[model samples]
Target: MERREFLAALPAAAVGLSLTETAKAQTEAEPFPGFQPPGVDRWERSDVEAGDRPVGASFGTRSEVFGRSGAAGTSHPLATLAGIDILRKGGSAVDAAIAINACLGFLEPTACGIGGDGYAMLWDPKAAKVVGISGSGRSPRSLTLEAVRSRLRNGFIPPYGALPVSVPGTVDMWWTLHGKYGKLKWAELFEPAIAYAEGGVPVPAVVAYYIRRGMTNFARPGMGIEELDNARATFAPGGETPGVGEIFRNPDLARTYRMIAEGGRDAFYEGDIARAIDAYFKRIGGWLSYADLAAHQSKWTQPYSTDYRGVRVHAIGENTQGLATLQMLNILEHFDLKGAGFQSPLSIHLQAEAKRLAYEDRARYYADPDLVDVPADWLVSKAYAAQRAKLIRPDRINDKIRPGDAPSRGDTTYFSVADRDGMMVSMIQSNFRGMGSGLVADGLGFMFQDRGQLFTTVDGHPNIYAPGKRPFQTIIPGFATKGDQPWLSFGVMGGDMQPQGQAQIIINRTDYGLDAQAAGDSPRWHHEGSSQAMGEDDPTLGPRGLLRLETGVPDRTAAALAAMGWKIGESDGGFGRYQCVERRMDGNERVYGASSEMRADGLALAY
Candidate 1:
């Protein structure tokens, strides 16, 4: 069959297989036919001391892990361990993912929680197909563009507060995904999170840093003082944020988990917990109501993909900027990324230009599919990408860029799990803008997400705030398949840095032949475009055009980019943290490679 024909047949072939049959077939055949082994030159020595700790040695660096039975990688070590434990107990990839997400809510509340939203891509080995889950929440039924504009300070929504609160969708998403793909009981999934929340888990260094940062920002004058007090009461407790290694407990969250465990999703969406959330929002001047919560339902949509060098990359459609990642990848595929060299000025410049073009389209047309018509298919088409790639000039930065005529279109914790049963899951959950909208429900032990703040008040805009509309989302989970079977599951978390990271990771693994860990750890470049009306800006961002490169990028490459009329600077965080699990078959034996973000306090574990 022709490549296009095979691409067209993938969905049907994947959906028709069953878990047992898929695994059996994989064992009988050579899984990755054209696979290339990792090159010897790709391995490098770590700068951090590995032996007994000496003075000035870095304490956080670690190595990637490999396994044959099961593997899991997440942003937190405890979450990774919890997922591995679930896998050991005969759980499916979805079950392990749910367990990991539950643990992350308590352990890394700054990134995700039941009070936020989530998305996932599940690879059904037997059926040989991928399934996408849109766990995003809708705006409050009462939220209107007029009401939003009336409250805007300068035609832009506040980063936090009641105006940004959307209906909590993470719990509903959890229940929905569990009902469809989970092997363990619903209540069993919450046990790890509940125990940790009630029995105090030590604050990891990264978690401690974010908690302190939150306290400082929230306590600043002119900020939300009442919300800060609630946050302090729950996270600080002793008049200060907890330090690294210090025990922190959230009894309220524990109770919330128990209630949900007992009554299923309704416990949070319709019962006493829901009542508490409604009361808290009402008192705080937010629009979320019981009706919003009651009406919320997670959608099981068909996953979308674009083929790059024979590998198909999949991401959730609509209400997400995920398709933009594929668009960027499609554009990048038109060039020889590996031939240009990793982190080379030519490589970085092309990627930045492609991303800028894709984002322009995103800002103009991407939004909730139910609310507006998005040319999803046309956006990722190679012909469209080729046309967009033409706008990328090799000699200089393109400043006159605008959305193409053909079609407009287009953070948070991300983790991946692959069980021994051949099931793999790539999932991301988030409370937009770390720690979310500061409004901690009176006794819920978690803060609500500020996702609604992303919506614009511009009349007729696709992402304009509206009743029951899902605002454009940044948190996305990514998956890739070779020959219509699970090959890679990964995600990179951080606002606009996500799609950039996704494109780079795919290039590093597929083109440069790097393993999962190296692909994640390699120097990253964040394309900082002009700040949108509702966006935040930093010194590193400007209209002159900026490409924030992580420390690992060569100074020469930075100089080259600068000579091309692009402002280049070093970035502190926003580069994004990545985690991935790649499944490779050696004959009939299934091998798993897992990676955790080097910038994070986590490790990849397999058994």
Candidate 2:
């Protein structure tokens, strides 16, 4: 029988719960072969048997999305739709991004939330240049390096706990963006997310997968976790996370959003929400206090750039690891990558060698410029990158790479939007280490970010644990321009893999001549276990770390990399997820092409 016919024939009284409610109960349903089961419809990879693409089409899993007036791309289908809705309502790119972010916080809270930090790179049409915004939050006012040391385990701050909690800057980020460029009302941005939170949304397969992992991690004992009851109550009702296609609701988050909508930035930073967070942390012996929240302020930073094939590629400056991309690009700019061939072992080795070298500087010099005398200008200098690039070899890994002179600077969610007026926004937000610090405020439904954990306890280090200092961050937004037009607003999501992925995307499109979709669809690599950004001084990790390759890479390339004295491993889906919206000129009219990550539930659309 059809679903409608079955529903009409069987009354609600026959079963204790409706189909959706049964799915939400987090139990396996009875098996009935050839029958459609509730909560089982998932977004799986398309079957290869569907037939290959026509000649000259994208080698990507899907065709590039095109739009003339505007475009939106995000990690989730719902959030992208929310962005499109806002744009249809006469909203600016910033407004659309704000709406998408708010919705993403509820739809994919394991990756981001209002209880986290964010950074953005904007392609402002009026300014005719890209701008950067640092929405990073600071450590607690009461915190001292010694007090933080007292809570350390194995010389490192616990990744998920009260000790790692920081003041969340995401609300302030929204307000700052709105005040500068928003077209719709301030309250309008929260409508879609608030409604979804109250009425509930069916959990997607990918989101459910992450929620399960994050919730289990929180439930693990001896992880320094405290006051987790609130988190558990909010995310995993009845001691379990919602299943795929199960309707999940968060009324507390809805109430919180409503409060922020009415009270503006003050509500989250200094009002009732702040008081609740302060009281909860105090009860749990945490560092964050009402004062920390009240004093928190987001900054407007400069977006640094370097030329690659004559295109201006921008990255967020100081206190973030964004400059690594510019430095990497600068180093590779001296090479002939088109001749080297895409995914060649030579190309991979060069990029990986440059990455560890750039990361060496990032670990040593990148810090809050306000606190440390970072070598800001020299870090992104072509001369400096060129000097460092000389150490890399074509046939071998540069295991001896280390920091030269410099200044210094996880799961994350990234989205990009473009409006009809020619403005583009590239924004990235995160609750660090998946679901943040694993502690929720008394009445609020969101978890605070664990960004404070990224700080090392070593005294005098550029990124050491200190009171009222913003810790090092992983999330970054990317933007690029061609001549005078807004070219690209994009970002790649992953801890430490962001810059590497951004570089790959740029090379893929600009040099390899791939379309928007094909650029993201191409196989990638990640280099991990390098000298630490969040580790103690003189970490014993050897220079030669494992280089993980995506499945699409050939066995011959893997063999070749191993022959070069490098350890090769298979990817565990950490390569990175990319999203982009590209703008081009088709004669007199403006044209757009957008791409979303095939590895994720995201989609790109234009109108």
Candidate 3:
């Protein structure tokens, strides 16, 4: 039978001991003999076949001597530890970020890379202010909407199509941030990354999971074995993608790193990398040019923020869905969330209502303010939040949640850093989809981002395609302050679910009084409509399901919520990891990080 029919035949019950036993028995007894699951539905790899198990190994190191020290939020403990090493060697936050980012490129290439884009929230403790860097890239100038539409009419959605390809700005943004705020020499920051890229870095469990799931997505015409092989020439002998715990290297990427280390942004924008990118674009009939690559630059903007209770919440400004997080917080501010307890139905219902409302506003108004006007002030206003709240029925989810008409705005990775000197950085970067457009340039050792696909094809849409204008984005890193004091540095990574997860993190920290890891590891209810893939993963997801709660939640809450008219579904709450560095008003810092144990392949460590 086909995968869909097989999934439809699976059980539809909440996660319980009974369900687990049944699933296990089915596996052992060879039940559903003809059934085959979709590739996306098979989230389990050899390592993470079962939930609630210890994930990959955890390791970290740190020093508090005060000349310089940095803490990172990254998937692999070794990568985070490497950043700390850079800090111990007198590297700044920017320096550590560059190091950790390059290491992630090596281990988690399916998540992000040198060919992607990044956005950063930098805090200069001495300056007592923050700098926002927009690392998002613009669409190729030559790929007009009309041209793309014509291609679509020809029954061709071009591989790394005109709609998805964008000028890469990650390297540019890295150099820009380092040039402004780094204490260590740029060449020194490149050491760990170059070593990892050239020598090899072991693949982590989660990174391996992404590769397997994204394999089919990576098999497009221009992004097949030939491309991955050419890109991995310097790293893998015959260009073989490494399995979990296997050593994978990218000497080509190391050379690319050295180019930037030696000549700053010029090495990438006007040199060999530029020529390589242009040549690839020309070969693919894409519109990106040397001029676009040379002209692309990172932007410095003020972070938009709102007061949630006593804590000041900051998110990326106008063009991003960062403000939507503030909107969610604003709506939740009017409710007594904690009074309902952690997993109570009342608590879940109230939060889901707030999420549905905020996302509606996000769909209507959030976009690039330079190209389309986003009413930021109105959307984030207390009155508007109150008005939106009135639409919630309290006991039931408003599934008819519509995207409000306003103005505007990823396998993504996020990691937060805090130094001994009070400098805190909340950074996020991604290639959009897993390994992004999946088109690795010949010798660049990286995949391009599919950011342009984020733009809507519809005319007059707030996020519609436009030249030199950024597409609506979801990679938001969060920075928060309490009455001018740096309170926390945090972020969560999961495509469209990012802002919702951010709001969940904030509420857990602020209202629920949970620390960073506790907040991240706690049960989460994502209200991003019912995902067909999610429904197939578990038997419990019915057609009307709007809320996907974790198995850890109390049965009383599920029954109560069902009676309250919620189409609730159960899940294992996979790899919901978050890293946070919190500081008190007394200047003492508590660096805390936690990842989901439910992730059969997750690890959270601190030093």
Candidate 4:
């Protein structure tokens, strides 16, 4: 058959298989780009030293766990262990997840706190379905566009800017998920996060890096550095950033978490903590109001899924660009992309164009569905994919492509849990940026999420700042299945690069036939336009290229992509790390995890 005819027959052929089957078949015939190890991954150890302080070193000793089959769970070690314990004791995946998340709020305070947002995707084998939960918050009504503009006019961005000052929705989301799917009480979930917080969970290396970085940004008066100091009385009484190996504690955060455990979500939304938060915003010129807290809620929605080869690709819908990942998959499905092989010039060019194309649609149309007329169907149509595919030239670079649809946007962490009962949870949580808004309610101890700062005040923009609107967010979770069979539960964290990373991971596994870690470790690339909106640290960061081979990618592939009109940037490979778990067909299951060695401290655990 001619190439086109052969390609034409593929869809019909693929329609008969599940994503897993198609991916396996493709891998059997042509291997995807496997890692070209520069040296043994240096940071593969279960434990390691990190940070400038002793507390950082103590964090290195923690372990992360991955498991498969009967039941498995993975997250930061403390959270993972907590979830695993819950599952072992008869908790459902949702139950374990809530427990793990609550623990992370205590142990991983630098990335998330009670004052943030969460998003989740779940797959249930018994029902053969997927469900979404949006725990993100809305902006305070009192903080209207004009109110935000005044702050900008005063020569201040709302802490990261007014965009992130929205109401926090994470607790509401947790309570909602637990109420519907949880087998354990919401109070049970709060145990770990509270004990870790009050008892002084030792600071991890990554936490220390952000703590020091946050201190630099939060030191201004009225900005809430004093709250951190007050919260850290047990952990860092001397005012010095806790060093590696030191015990770090937060009695205040512990007390706050305990109130939630006993009082439920209402503790934060209606009680003293709420008052402290409202008072803090008032004093600091922030826009959040008591009504915003009273109005907060987490919503449940349907997820968008597409068949890539044989495996089902599922993601959160429109309030986020999680579907953009699916749109990219849909576009690439039209071509026999695997025939190009990974790392070849033609392959690199095609992937880059696919990303550019998808992002174009993202910038032009994606936003909170309630607030905008996003052409969701049109954006992912096969016809649109084919049209976008034409923009890629087999021989040249397409750097001039502009953002057509994206309206503009995390210590967010992801953990996937599956219990023996067959309940699956794909959960992600965050404070928005590292250390969040840097404002802690006086006695609350936890930092607020700067999530609101993601909105713009510009008139007519889809994601413009408004009274009670949710901002563009980075924290999203994904779930997938093959027909009625549970396939995989996963998520990746990074700011604007998240959906891009999700697409890359799925493409690597489904199209390229790589395991999760390999897909994660392989050289990766993201379009430059998205990176530019993130401000000076990101925009002026430098020239970016397609196929950034992790420090582990073979030099040959790096050279190949560079030769293909791509500017290659080499790094220590520590910036991007992913945690993933898979349930294989062999009746036995496995959890495989990896962290970027490029990061001074990252650990992947499995048993």
Candidate 5:
């Protein structure tokens, strides 16, 4: 009998079973001998094979919430719920964040996964200080500038394929954070994600959209199905992407998580998983090795901060663009953004000019700290910002700005978590570009990050490609403190939009007195690349500068920016998705405030 005929013949009640139960029942029945379900693990059946479907359609508008116990916010409602569940189980904020991020790896694969890198900022209430975790992986020892240039077409590595793959650092970071601040057993944190992976989650609307987009790209001519077999097998089984309400499962990922839970980090870094990854890289002509995986370690670094209007802004130092956000905020501190009015021409221009100056320095100086001297303290110094602020003209845009002498400074999904005890966690993770390098380890069910592509091929450049050197990263986690107490934990997920979003959120909250939710919901603008010099076309920026403003920005604001020589374009989706949790004093008691982005299919939940 045909598959459709078999399905049609089933009883309505059988059909009504949640997708997970239906699959298990069919497998148990063994209707056809030797038949195996798509994406099922051969070794063992998942323990939790069925559960209730996710509730409600995303309304795209979430209210700012206040909670006395705890608050959690993320780019996905399910992930947020998972974090809250952890907190309810008497886990710390770090434990909740780890659980939340693990779920995101399974649910939002387009933005992040176990194969990517991560950075986090955690406020330890006992220690009374914010600690930074750098989970970024280094380049393969065999991958060198000469080797990369020999394969490059125009001094730029292709965005996809094995060439751009980097060693994954997320798993290491997870274990490191958990070992220090986690209140629950490491295995316990993986339970929620494992259950979701096995029970089959309903595809979220945003995830379905990105999955379809990826399928379309992979189906194009010359991009054979065999090249991304693992991806197709996991995300597009049956040669079709799942729709928003359809159930999707990855038993392989569930198994992988279980192994890591049992064997700790060694299962992923030095055991069968690592060996399989090494073999896969060899087959694909990639440079990663088992030694690199075994040698990879996560670092606990002191977070760097800058004072902006009495609020101390903390960001991960080195190899990340977090410092750039601080610099931008410093420059904007010299101006009265609130008095200029939200989205006003003067405000927009000043923000854009500051970003341009910050990015110029970022492109020049930000890189792996272990490999180069990153002048982090000098970059975030108020005096240096004052010097860069002088380059911004109130009357017109300045296109001649260059990297300052002070030196610098780095896409991705972000989620923020805060527990009732006032401990906060701000975390960001990514694969550098959408869907990452598109290289899934054979049967591992995850994509390797394309972060290495960000390294410059130029000799002597701060971000120059080198063996065992980490590339400059775009994903950053933002944290803010007031009077040495945890005040805010937030992050924005998008390539260069991260720092830009960070600066805007701070300005909106501090200068305009907007609540966390309102601050994230406000319309925003992004300045893409630098302007061309006269008739010369910048190889990096093409011909002209492009300014993208969301629809919320008034037409007059765009016109005013355009009149000042910026090529303005309207953007449908605003700058990026933002998630934030702020701790505020409600009289004598401290309360938590949480906010989720309006442009995303997520919610801010409190309990």
Candidate 6:
């Protein structure tokens, strides 16, 4: 069939077409100028880290673990160990996760703490399906859009300060998760974290780096912060972020956790903690109040999914950008990526283009479902993706692509936990943008999330700021099932990188036949300059954005992409940090494999 004829025959919403490899190859747009060498990959070099690998290891690989009872993959080794300890004590995955998350507050507080919002996806063996929850908080009841608009200095919410602070939801989410899926007492879960908080643990390299960076940014002028004394006194007490291996303690946090342990979730939301937060914000002239904290509630959400190569990928729906992953997967499902080869120029181009296309819709549709009527069903449907996929020309980038009448917009910590009984959890929590708003409530020991900064100030946008509204969130956790069985629990941490990085994980495992560790270990590509759903007017973003490749990607691929109208650049470690746990039945026993990102101070352990 001719190029036009091939596309014509495919139905607008059909899926699982058995297109041949040769036919798929023909779909590639003729290379721009047809002269750039297909840039070859630099897979191995003696000067770099690798020396030897296990028989089944993938590139830049580490030892992936397998276990029959349980596994935990966390950004911090200490946090991972805490989770394992919880599992050993007969805790469920949710229980282990609560423990791990609590530990991360002290160990990796630059990314997560109780003051942040949280989102999660889980596989409940008893229910035999995936479950999801949205722990995002509402803007203060008294803070109107006019109030927010009057406060914007740069015509957008700044990354740090009380202006962007929202009533945190992580504490409530923890109780919710525990109430539904936990097998251990809630107070017991915080025991490990509380002890560690009081005793002090040595700061790791990655957290230390973010601390220095976050403290510097928080201290910068014009960040909308009325006070920096609290933050400086809380985190950088010595006038700087703690150095790696330096012992760090948060006795304030310890006392706070102790209160939560005794008072339940109410301790944070309805009790003394909330009062303290309310008082601090009032003192600082911020919006949040005790009424806002007391009124906060996080809801359970039905996760959205897409079929990709026989696996069902699941993520939290709107109010978050998670659905964009499903949409991207839907578009890429049309191509014979397996034939193009893993990490090849053609494959990378296809992924990048798919991201650009889906994100256009992201800028148009994703919003709080309670307030906006997002066509969630149509957005991720195979039909919508099939129609959208046709816009791409094999050789050229589609700069004119716009939203298909659709819409959305952190830094975050993502972790995975699985227990012996088959329950699995994918959890991501964050304070947003380098250690959150620069306000730490008196004696509470955690910074309020800067997530409100993600709300676009564009007039009449669905995601515009409003009292009692949830801002468009940046963190998402994901789960996947294969052949109706719990398959994978995974997530990637970084604002905007979560969805794309996750899509690549599925593609790597299914299309490229990579094992769990290698799927995460392989070099990745990240795209920059997507439309910010800002209703236009902002000048920096262009029609087609820049494509950034990791160090291991070949120059040939970059050359090929540039020839095809892509502007290529190198990465600044923003690709994302991934963690995952995969389950498979080996003969009669169920076994699990865990993988953690090499880019962060993370670890994957099984037992």
For each candidate in turn, the TM-score is 0.88, 0.91, 0.82, 0.80, 0.87, 0.90
Comparing 3 with 5 on lDDT, the higher-scoring candidate is 5
> RMSD, each candidate, Å?
15.0, 9.7, 8.5, 12.9, 13.1, 11.9
For model 2, the superposed segments whose C-alpha errors exceed 4 Å read 1-51, 55-59, 406-410, 532-541
* Candidate 2 lDDT, 41-136, residue by residue in tens: 432332222246774333568887899888999999989999999999999999999999999999998899999999998888888888889999
Give lDDT tens digits, candidate 4, residues 100-187.
7777776666666677888988876666788888887887787666767766623324555334567788888888888877777777
* Clashes per model (N, Cα, C within 3 A): 7, 8, 7, 45, 4, 12
Give one digit per residue, the lDDT tens place, for model 5 in 219-260. Answer: 677542236878789889898988888999988888899999
Q: Where does candidate 6 stray beyond 4 Å?
A: 1-49, 406-409, 532-539
Considering lDDT, which of the candidate structures 2 and 4 is the better prediction for this target?
Answer: 2
Q: State candidate 5's TM-score.
A: 0.87
For candidate 1, what is the TM-score? 0.88
Backbone clashes in model 2: 8
Model 3: how far residue 437 lies from native, Å: 0.7
Q: How much is 101 displaced in model 4, in angstroms?
A: 1.1
Candidate 5: residue 499 lDDT (0-100): 89
For residues 298-379, could you state the per-residue lDDT of candidate 1 as single tens digits?
Answer: 9999988999999999988768889889999999888888889877999988889888888877777778999889888888
lDDT agreement with native, every candidate: 0.83, 0.85, 0.69, 0.66, 0.83, 0.85
- Name the regions of candidate 1 deviating beyond 4 angstroms: 1-63, 224-226, 407-411, 531-544
Candidate 5 or 2, higher lDDT? 2
lDDT score of residue 490 within candidate 3:
78
